[model samples]
Target: MEFNNNIPIYIQVIEKIKQEIVTGKLKPGEKMPSSRDYGNNLGINFNTVARVYKEMEMEELLFTRRGLGTFVTESEDRIGQLRYEMAKKQIENFIFNMKQIGYTKKDMIKFIETENYLEGDE
Candidate 1:
């Protein structure tokens, strides 16, 4: 849960929580750590964790039970879909940037091949 100085802290926190949920570390309907607990665990401010939770709630990825605690939503597929969409958007942006930099379709294909190989190695 090391915070990146380049990205917004809350967004990073959101990604961490989302990663946990997607990886089955936090299962459907499982209670998440409280804001205070998360903050302590990550050495971040409680308000930052709170904001991340609030954003997740808006996205329907989490729900808070009055006094019980926030829990990962039961619709795990929705979270998966959201992650897919986000990754798609990022890749689209990368392609657009490459095009802007005058990369040809062949070059793009080669780059993708290299990326696939690298990813496979991982």
Candidate 2:
């Protein structure tokens, strides 16, 4: 995972994990990599990976089974909530950026309706 100097690395990791969960890329109840392996894979410190897991568990986005490993939360409702929150955040960011460029709410709505987004499909 590439690091963004402006933001804390742990935050970036948490966001990516949340996105994966919301998008179904990381299935509910799927066992996550052990902190050591995950740290190695991401070329980050083990403490960092541990911190990520701890924070996620605190958020109820993950759970750890004794003697087992951390897993993605299995609650569909929780995942749905996460999805909605992520989308809302993205929209808020978009609105802020558009306003910064002197675009109003009406302009944003108009652009959304008329823009050819096919060229930017990812």
Q: Per-residue CA lDDT of candidate 1, range 1-122, in tens? A: 66678999999888877777777888899999999999999898999889999999999999999989999999958878877877888889988999999998899989888778567564
User: What are the TM-scores, per candidate, against the unseen true structure?
Assistant: 0.79, 0.92
| lDDT of every predicted structure (CA atoms) | 0.88, 0.93
lDDT accuracy of residue 15 in candidate 1: 80
**Pairs in clash, predicted candidate 1:** none
Q: Which numbered prediction scores highest in lDDT against the true structure?
A: 2
Error of 2 at 66 (Å): 1.1
Error of 2 at 95 (Å): 0.8
**Candidate 2 wrongly placed segments (more than 4 Å):** 118-122
Taking the tens digit of each residue's C-alpha lDDT, what string does model 2 give over 27-64?
A: 99999999999999999897998899999999999999
Question: Which residue ranges in model 1 land beyond 4 Å of their true spot?
Answer: 114-122
